[model samples]
Target: MFREVPVLPVVVPVAAAVFLILLWYLHSRDRLSAPRAAVALALCVYAAGVVANTVFPIFLDKPARSALWKVYLVPFANYEVGDAVTNILVFVPIGVLVPLLVAKAPWWRVVAVAAAFSLVIELTQLVTRNLLGGGHVADVNDLIFNTAGGALGFGLCSALSRVPAAAALIDRFRWR
Candidate 1:
């Protein structure tokens, strides 16, 4: 049953956002944690959506289309390797920024989140290809590289957070 299931990468973070928001509402007493979690969830979803939109079709044999039926274009050859590179580049920021922005998140937690995000995306592609007769092939490289990118992002964010100017800028964005 799982093998034939259609997985949508965009849906993973979307669902996560919805779940986090519901949890936040239910636990309104913990204002700090709830808000942080909500922001983290939103960032995760946004990053995932961007990655999916940019990289998903690179793995497809055919071009993905817009709502108006216009075909999307990839400047480079649409191939497995290109898809892998794009996916990794797209999600690294998610892995990095989420942890830095959410103060209490540990390094390990950030890694875990990145890994989960990558796994969900790969699984989604696998299921989508299997059920839809699409040519999208799930690549293990994507899982590795995407997670690495996220970890890299986390490190960058962590390092940047220490700079007084960067810290001040981030402080301005915090919800009151």
Candidate 2:
């Protein structure tokens, strides 16, 4: 049950302010340009969307459930295609953008960062479920599929980077 409360009315404005401030800071410091700012904004929006989707809609009433949080440690157990695909797609942008944004990001580093990001999200869900009524559970399959998606995106980025025209276009938007 991944139900989220209708709190975006407040969250969106706050997130927008934060994103604007960050973009301003980076631009003032000569670390960002118009195109780079656009890229940064896209990354910020994607990250916010992921967090919102995974961690919101808490169960404040604490319905007679045994525990406030739950985890599925069994990998690939009763895996659903929709869930797996969603998890993978959610992480694919991280894989593509990290390498594009960082000057020295290798494929392994991309994968590692994706896994760490997924771990942080899962841990947050665990804590938030207990403290704030979040209903999402940590699942090993999610972690696995998220990493796989990142890997796939990295491969796609790598291949695209090898193409002269594609590389030129990517370099145009690349921050580093």
Winning model by TM-score: 2
RMSD of each: 9.4, 2.8
The CA lDDT of each predicted structure is 0.61, 0.81
Clashes of 1: 3
Clashing pairs in 1: 92-149, 96-153, 96-154
Q: Give Cα distance to truth, residue 126, candidate 2, Å.
A: 1.6
Lowest lDDT 10-residue stretch of candidate 2: 60-69
Per-prediction TM-score: 0.57, 0.86
Clash-forming residue pairs, model 2? 4-57, 58-133, 58-134, 59-133
Candidate 1 lDDT, 1-176, residue by residue in tens? 12222337555856677767645653574545544555656665676575555335433333343233222234333447676677667767776566645657677888888888877776766655554434455556666777877888778777877999997765543343
Q: Per-residue lDDT for 86-145 in model 2, tens only?
A: 888888898898986788799999999999999998988877776666777788888999
**Candidate 1 residue-wise lDDT at 173:** 37
